[model samples]
Target: MLAQRAQLPDGRWHFQHGPMDIVIGAHGSPASVDAAHAAAWQRFTGILDELVQELVALRRPVQGDCPVLGPIARRMWQACQPFQRSFITPMAAVAGAVAQELVACYERSGVTRAWINNGGDIALHLEPSQSVRIGLYADIARLGLDEIRDGILTDGQFDVSSVLPVRGVATSGWRGRSFSLGIADSVTVLARTASEADAAATVIANAVDLDDERILRRPACELKDDTDLGYLLVTVDVPPLEPDRVQQALRAGLKRAQTLRAAGLIWSAALVCQNQIVTTGDPATKKLENRRAHQQLGSVFA
Candidate 1:
């Protein structure tokens, strides 16, 4: 089927083509908003086909010269390059790269603030003095349609301001659309670009792990024959663990996030598993808001 789009009741636009389902919103003059939406749609129409043409290289582990020619594909590769020391592929950042591309259309004059949410991966544009409040959902499996339809019953919330140097947000977990080696319920990251956040979230989520007899895992290829992870084992089921074990896993993930933050690959991150949470920054200092019932989407490939 061809790409399709519809306007949401709240004035946001939803664009869907194959595996891509994006929600775009902008606050600006009517003329600018309309033009940006049009431009974004025009750009979105051909992205899937472009990625399809380079699927083989996109699925390969990051190493050596870039293998994809498409702009978005190259962005994905560059985003994952910092983690080339690990086994990351360009696919890890695909959703965020796509969102970033569309969000660019809203960066022109008159658009004070705009956001493109590709599943849970997001790209943002904020002019001077503008900001946006983002809700967080600690667990994707518990995200219901009602919560998404109404206001998300956010577990926590944070504001991203124009001065913050943040423009991207992404989440990943074992329970998400993509395979994860760790048992985290969710790992959310903020970065200077959506592609970086997506890649970092994936890496951090994969680090939130510990040896546990109750956890079940299977080879990535067993679940999806064409998965980029190949024979790597991925978490399938995680049983309730002792409190100490949970803390151990969260600490491991926290360390990984801190390393990325120090490297400037990520601004901050929050990791959650089995109801416990860990963050790279102090919540009070960061002014992050804690609330009940807010929901967020799981990370997915573009």
Candidate 2:
């Protein structure tokens, strides 16, 4: 299928083809910004087709001697390679890889700042002294419920001048578009690259599990025919749990996030399960402690 592009009312560029949908915003000289958009569109046009060419390999578990011809597919493969011993497939990094690729296109055009948001996985380009604020959704599915009606949902504001290592952000949960193996309401991760954040978010979200019978799971393939997880059990529903149980699940995921952070696979992570939340990373980076509404974004540094 051919890729389609449109300019949103608010001035962002939207590109979509197949399952990949991206929204991009850039700031710089008008000439550079326009060039970046053109480049992004050029790079995005054939990406879905290239990925489809290697769909079978991308879906397979990473192992010795697997070959893929597409650059983005290779990026996906490399991103998931660190977790090869696990059940991960290159597909786990698809969204982030796409975001990263598009952001790279923008960077080459000399944009001072840009962000490519592929679904909820984001790749950011921040020139020195420029920064952006990001909205953190504690639990997207529960955003509008009475419990969160107070509108106290906190938004994370990052100053690129202070925390330069982070350029990618991604979130995962059972309620998200993708199937998850754990009960985390949301698991957001930051990394040097969007691909890493995407892979780590999936892994951390999967680690946020407990043996509670109230959680519902089903074979992933049964829910989606082309799911990379195949027959692996994926969380389908999570019923209300005691506060203590929520903490237990969040702690489990926290341990995994800490390990990944120490290993340099991730910069930081915010994990939420029910009403409980845990964060691991550099303390200097801003964090959202409590949030009640759906995610909202605002600029922290102009």
Candidate 3:
């Protein structure tokens, strides 16, 4: 089943359920928070069934003009639209789509600034002087498998937020919850919205590796009974990579990201593997958390 969960809180209220995994809270009137929660739940209810239904329809290529019945489904289709001919299914961007829709629920209302965090793909509406502390996982391929790439890419766990104008965050790597094309552990990107970030992350993740036979791969459908990928092979495993090979793989993903960034598809990105860190363009509205600051701070100081 898809992972979309939601939750609302008053006094540090913690909520979690379904494929829509979210941890959200607002700073405003109680009524505002309640409204946000209700909206989230409204969007949350019956999503799994809806997504499953959509998955059934997307089993094969679009025969003709397919009706857009589900919100997330429609969004998924739109995300994959640009690369439809390249062999992509809507399911690949489902998490980001869910994140976008749930975030919309709050925006629909009159919330000054709100956040809808679905797992790590978050959509945010920031009022003036608002920000989010987005935690970045170790793997970049978490975005999706890059069938075109040969191996994997990885980085240490960290945090980065997409604030104000920036609203989306996504990770792609072979080591994440989702399968990856490259061997990268994680690749994160932040964009204007969760959907854009989600889609862009998939594209970048695909570029993280070289196309070679050494990497183990399996069809997406084989990995699961109700996968959106149908017969497409999702990245499953990776063998050791030589020093030069790792550099080549990282460069491939980086080159792809450069093109994407130039095209305005993304605002900023952080590419990490082994112990190396490569940041391209600006990191968008925010920057990485200074690890040294934490270390320098006294243990007594938070």
* lDDT, candidates in the order shown: 0.87, 0.81, 0.61
For model 1, the local distance difference test gives 0.87
lDDT of 2: 0.81
User: Model 2: per-residue lDDT, tens digit, 209-233?
Assistant: 8998878999999999878898999
Best by TM-score: 1
* lDDT (C-alpha) at residue 240 in model 3: 68
* TM-score of candidate 1 relative to the true fold: 0.94
Q: Measured by C-alpha RMSD in angstroms, how accurate is candidate 2?
A: 3.4
List residue ranges in candidate 1 displaced over 4 A.
145-151, 282-302
Compared with the true structure, what per-residue lDDT tens digits does model 3 show for residues 128-204?
55565544445333435572254322222332333335777776666666666665655677777677777777777
Which 10-residue window in model 3 sums to the lowest lDDT? 293-302
- Candidate achieving the largest lDDT: 1
TM-score ranking from best candidate downward: 1, 2, 3
lDDT of 1 by residue, 158-207 (tens): 77888887999999998888899999888888999999999999999999
Query: Which sections of candidate 3 miss by over 4 Å?
Result: 1-18, 59-67, 108-110, 139-164, 211-214, 285-302
